[model samples]
Target: MAHDLTTPRDGIPPVLSTPASFREAAAALASGQGPLAIDTERASGFRYDDRAFLVQIRRRDVGTFLLDPEGHRTEFTAALAPVLNGQDWILHAAPSDLPSLAWLGLYPGSLFDTELGGRLAGLDHVNLAAMTELLLDVRLAKGHGAEDWSQRPLPANWLAYAALDVELLLELGDTMAEILDNQGKLDWASEEFEYIRNTHSTITGPAEATWRSVRGVASLTRPEQLAVARELWMIRESIAVEEDRAVSRILPNKVLIEIARLLPRTARELVRVKGFRRSEVRFWGEIIQRALESDPRTWPTRDRPPRGLPSRQTWAAEHPDSWERFSNARTLLDDLSADLAIPVENILKPAVLRTVAWGATVGREIRSPLDLPDVLRDYQARNWQVELTAPILTETLFR
Candidate 1:
C-alpha cells in the first residue's frame, strides 16, 4: 500500500538562523550515524541570484535540520564543515543543488545522486517524487518549490515541505544503490558521483551573449533588431540584478522582443506593446527608449555566435565522408545504449562523438579503441564512457 508523507517523521526543526543554532544542528548531525540526506531550496525563478536560502539536512538518528544560509552566511560554512566534509551525501539531482551548496562553502566528500542512479539503472520517471513513490511507495506533496525562499519569516507549511524533500532521500539513495550494485553498474555510478562532487560550478559564456539565449531571438533576422534585443536584455538584466528579481519577472521575453522589433520611440509607443502596457512602462519606459534610440552603427554584428563545432546540417553538406562516419557511430551507439539500458547521451556526448568521428577520418591515428583517450582528451570523455563505447566506435571508423 502507498503511504502519503504529509509531515516529517521527527517534525520540522526550527530554521537554524543564528550561529549558536547552526552549531547545535551541526553537533546533532555529527553525533548522528549513517549517510547525510541533503537538499537545498533556492529562489531561482523569483530572485536575481541563485544562492540557497534554505539548506535542509537529515541523517539516520538526527531528524531534520533546516539552515537559513542567508542569515548566517559567514559562519554557517565553518560550523557545519566538520560534520558534512567527507561524509556520504544522499541527494536527488546533485548537480542542481551542489553548486548552490558549494557557494555556501559546503562540499560533500562523497555522494549518491539518486536521479542519476535511477537513469543508470534503466528506470524512467527518475524525478524525486516519482522515484520515491515507485521505490518506497511514498507520495510527496508537490508545488511550493518556486516560492521566494529569501522572504523573511518562512511559513510553517513551507518549512514542512522543505523538510520532506530530504525525508526519503536517503531511503531512495539506498534503493537505487542496491539496484545499481545488482546490475553491476555500482562502480560506474560511483565514478559519476565523484565527478559531480569535484566539478566546480561556474556560469559559461560571455555576459553579452547571454541575451541571445532569450526565447525568440533566433527569429529576428535584422542585425539592428538583434542589437535592440541585446540592449533590452542587458537593460532588463541590470534592473533585475539591482532589484533582486527574476529577469522574466521584470520583463517577459515575448514583450522584450516586441519592443525591439517595433523600436518604440517614446514612453507612449513603448507602453502600447502587449506586455509593457502596465506598471512596467511607468518603471522602465525611459530605459527602453534609450536602448532603442542608440545609433544603428553600434548594433551587434550579423556574424554567427562562436561555437565549438558547426551544426549537423553544415557538417553533412561540408564533409560527406565524416558525416557518414558520424551516422554509423550514432547507429552503433544507439545499439550499445539499448543493450546496456543506458541513454546514448550518457554513453558518450554527441559533440564528443562528432569530434572523434571527424578526427578519425581526417589524418588522425586511431588504431584501436584504446587510442580514443588521446583523441578525446580535450573532449573529456570519462574512462567508463570510453571503455564501453570505444570498441564499437573503432570498428565503425575502420570498417
Candidate 2:
C-alpha cells in the first residue's frame, strides 16, 4: 500500500519542476476536493527567525510533495505568487512559518491551522504526530536532525523525511474535522483558522519592537515598560542588524524583562539582575544603563496593577463561595477539554481563567471568547463590584 501510495524509491521526483510540472500537480491537487495539510521545517538555529527552509504540502487525495525553496532556481517570489495570493493553506501553529512564507512574497489568502483547530475541538495533545496517532492510529517517525539544508547534495533520507511531514496532513485534517464535527466545535475551529488567515502581515526589520512580542508585559507600569522596551529594542535592533544575528541571541527576553523590572540606573546596578549573561551584559550594558539614566522623572514610579495587586486571598475571605465556584469552573473546563479531546490551555488560558473567577465572584458573566479586551472587560466589571462591596464584605462577611 505504501509503495503504491508514494512515489517510488527511485525516480525523478514530481515536486517543483518546470512551470508545466507545477501546473499539472497544482491542477491535480486543486481537484482533490480536500483541504491541504501543510508543515514547514526551517534552519531556525542557523536563521535569525522561524522560517520554512523546506515546505511540505500534502493533499489527502494526491499525496505529499516537498518544495526546496533554496533549490530549483525557482523564483518563489514569482512562481508561488498566485498560491499565496489565493489558496487557504492548512498549517499547524501558523506563526512560525509566517515570516518565511511572507518572505517568499506569497501571502496565504486563508489558513486552516490544524493545531489551533484541535485546541478549539478540545484535544489535549495537539502535536502533529500525537494527533496522527489518535486520529489515524499511525505513528509518524521523528525527522529532526542537524543536517543543514543550505549544503549541496541534500540526502535522499532528508528529502523523504521532509515529504513525510505533509503526506498525512490532509487525512489528519479530515479525521480531526470528523472529531470536531462530532464534538460540535467545528465553528470554533473555523473561527481560529479564519482568524489566522485574515491576520495582517508580520512586521520585520528595525521598525519592529520586541515589546509587542513580550509576554506578561502588562504586569509592568505602562510608561516604564514602554520606555525600557523602546530603549532595549533600539539597542537590540542596532546590534542585531550590525551582527546579522537574532535579537534573542544577543539578549533573551527574560534578561530584557529583568532589566526593565530592576530599572537599573547604572552599570553596577544592572549587573545584579538575575540571569544577566556576562557576555550580553558586557555587550549592551552601557546601552541599557544609558536608557535607565536618561530620566528618573520620566520613568514610571507608579505601582503596576496585578503585579502585587490585592491578593485573591482577600477576595476569598470576603466571598467564601468564590473560591469554590472558581475551582468548580476550572475543574469543569479541564474535564471538558479532556473528554472533548482538546487542550485545557486552548479552551481558557490561565489569565482568562483568573478573570472568570474574579468576575463570577462579583456576579459577572464570562461571555466573551478569550481575547485581551474581553479579559479587560472582565477585570473592570469584577473590580467595580468588588470595590463597592469591599468594606461591607470585609467587615460583616469576614466577622
Candidate 3:
C-alpha cells in the first residue's frame, strides 16, 4: 500500500536563519554520518534571479536542517563547507539546484543525482514524486513548487513540503543504484552524475538577440519591426532586473510581439494593443514609446551570429550526401538506444552527431570511424560516450 508522507520522518526543524543557528546546524551536519541528502527551492517564476531562497539537507545522524541562504549568506557557506566538501551529496535533480547552491559558494566534491540514475536505469518517470512512490512507496505532496520562496516567514505547510523533499532522497538513491548495478549500467550512471557535478550551467552567458527567441519575432519581416522587438525586449529586461520581477510578469512575449508588429508610436497607441492594456503597461508605457520612437537608423541592422551550430533541418538541402550519412548514423543510434534501453539523446547528442557527419564529408580528413574519437574530442564528447557510440558511428559513417 502507498503511504502519504504527511510530515518529515523526524519532524521539521526550525529554519536556521541566524549566524549562530547556521553554525550549529553546520557543526551537526559536519559530524553527521553517511551521505548528505540535499535539495534547494528557488523563486524562479516570481523573481528575476534564480537564487536559492531555501536549502534543505538531511543526514542519518544529524536529522534535517533547513537553511535560509537569503539572509545568512556569509555564515551559511562557511559553516556548511566542512560537511559538504568531499561528501557524496545525493539530490533528485542536481542540475536545478547546483547552480544556485554554487552561487552561495557551496559545492559538492561528489554527487549522486537520482534523476540521472533513474534515466540510466531506464525508468520512464524520473521525477521525485514518481520515483519516491515507485521505489519508496511514499506519496509526496504537490502544488508547492511554484510558491514564492522569496516571501518571509514561510508557512508551516510550505516548510513541511520543503523538508519532505530530501526525506527519502537517500533511500531513492540506494534503490536506483541497486537497479543500475543489476542492469550493468552503474558505471554509466556514475559517469553521468560526475558530468552533472562538473558541467557548467547552460544559462551562464547573456544570450545574443534574445528577442529572436520570442515566439512571433520570425513573423515580423521588416527591419524596423525587428528593431522595435529588440528595443522592447531590452527595456523589459532592464525593468525586470531593477524591480527583481520576472519578465513575463512585467509583460508577456505575446504582448511584446504585438507591440513590435503594430509599431505603436504613443502611450495611447501602445495601450490599444490587445495585451498591453494591463496596469503594468500603464507604468511602462513611456519606456515602450521611447524604444519605438528611436530613429530607424539607430535600430539594429543585423543579429549576431548564433552561438551554437545551425539547425539540422537545413542540412539536407545544403549537403545531400552528408545528410544521407547522418541519417544512417541516426538509424544506428536508434537501434543502439533500443537495445540498451537508453534514450537516444543520452547515447549521443544530435548536435555532436551532425557536426561529425558534416565534418566527415566537408573539409576534413576523417577516413574511418576510428578517426571519430578525434572528431568527438573536438566536440567535447566524454570518453565513456565516445567508447559506447564510436564503434557504431564508425561502421555507419565509414560504410
**Best candidate (score: TM-score):** 3
Q: Each candidate: what lDDT?
A: 0.82, 0.60, 0.81
Per-residue CA lDDT of candidate 3, range 1-399, in tens? 789997887787798888888889888887888889999999979888788999999998778999998777878878887678668899988988888887777777788999888887788998999999988899988669889999999998899999999988888888988999999988888888887777733433333437788888877877778887887788888888899898888788898889878887666787788867556665666665666677877876545545544456767778777778889989989888888888888888888887787767653667766788978877777777889889877776777
Q: What C-alpha lDDT, on a 0 to 100 scale, does residue 149 get in candidate 3?
A: 95
* Candidate order, TM-score descending: 3, 1, 2
lDDT of 2 by residue, 1-399 (tens): 121222223332444645555555556666665556666667645445554567666665666666666644345445555544566677777766666666666567667777777676666688877777777776665556445554445666676666666666766767777877887777667755665565535533223445556654555665665568668867776876686566667767787877776777666777788777655555566776566567867754433445321367876787767766666666766665577666666555556556555554554553322332444434432332233223322332222
Report the Cα lDDT for residue 153, model 1. 95
In model 1, which runs have C-alpha deviations exceeding 4 angstroms? 201-227, 266-274, 282-285, 292-314, 362-370
At residue 241, give the lDDT of candidate 2. Answer: 64
Clashing pairs in 3: none
Better of 1 and 3 by lDDT: 1
Query: For candidate 1, what's the RMSD?
Result: 3.3
TM-scores, in order shown?
0.87, 0.64, 0.89
Output the number of the lDDT-best candidate: 1
